[model samples]
Target: MPIVNVQMYSGKNQREKDILAVAIIEDVSKILSVSEEEVMILFTEAPHGK
Candidate 1:
């Protein structure tokens, strides 16, 4: 299993997040030789400039 932790400022909307998550999942799974189900993406959002 591969876990990707993304920490970024909190300003993006749901559509952006969804698109990013899907892209990340696809690339990570392909590069890591893991199934999409085994690839995990965790986002930790914070206030801008925080």
Candidate 2:
């Protein structure tokens, strides 16, 4: 199993996240020669201002 951690600012909407997740999963799966189900995307978001 491959775990992909994505750290970013907490501002993206659900649709944006969905799009990004799909793209990452597709590319990662193809490059790693693994199934899409095996690729996991973890998003850690940081809020703006302290």
Candidate 3:
């Protein structure tokens, strides 16, 4: 199983997050020769103070 963790400023909407997750999973799956279901993606959203 491949685990992916992505952290960034909290700004994207649900659709964007879904798209990002799918893209990441696909890339990881292809690279690791594993199924998409075997990949785990974790997103950590954080606030950015200006």
**TM-score, each model?**
0.90, 0.92, 0.93
Candidate 3's TM-score reads 0.93
Candidate 3 runs further than 4 Å off: none
Candidate 1 residue lDDT tens string, 1-50:
89999998999998999899999999999898889999888999999872
lDDT of 1 at 5: 95
Q: Write the per-residue lDDT of candidate 3 for residues 1-50, one digit (tens) a residue.
A: 89999998999998999999999999999999999999999999999879
* Each prediction's number of clashing residue pairs: 0, 0, 0
What lDDT tens digits, residue by residue, belong to model 2 across residues 1-50?
Answer: 99999999999999999999999999999999999999999999998887
Task: Show where candidate 2 strays beyond 4 Å.
Answer: none
List clashing residue pairs in candidate 3.
none
User: Which wins on TM-score, candidate 1 or candidate 3?
Assistant: 3
20 in model 3: Cα distance from truth in Å? 0.5
- Backbone clash tally for model 3? 0
Arranged by TM-score with the best first, the candidates are: 3, 2, 1
User: In model 1, which regions exceed 4 Å deviation?
Assistant: none
The model with the greater lDDT, 1 or 2, is: 2
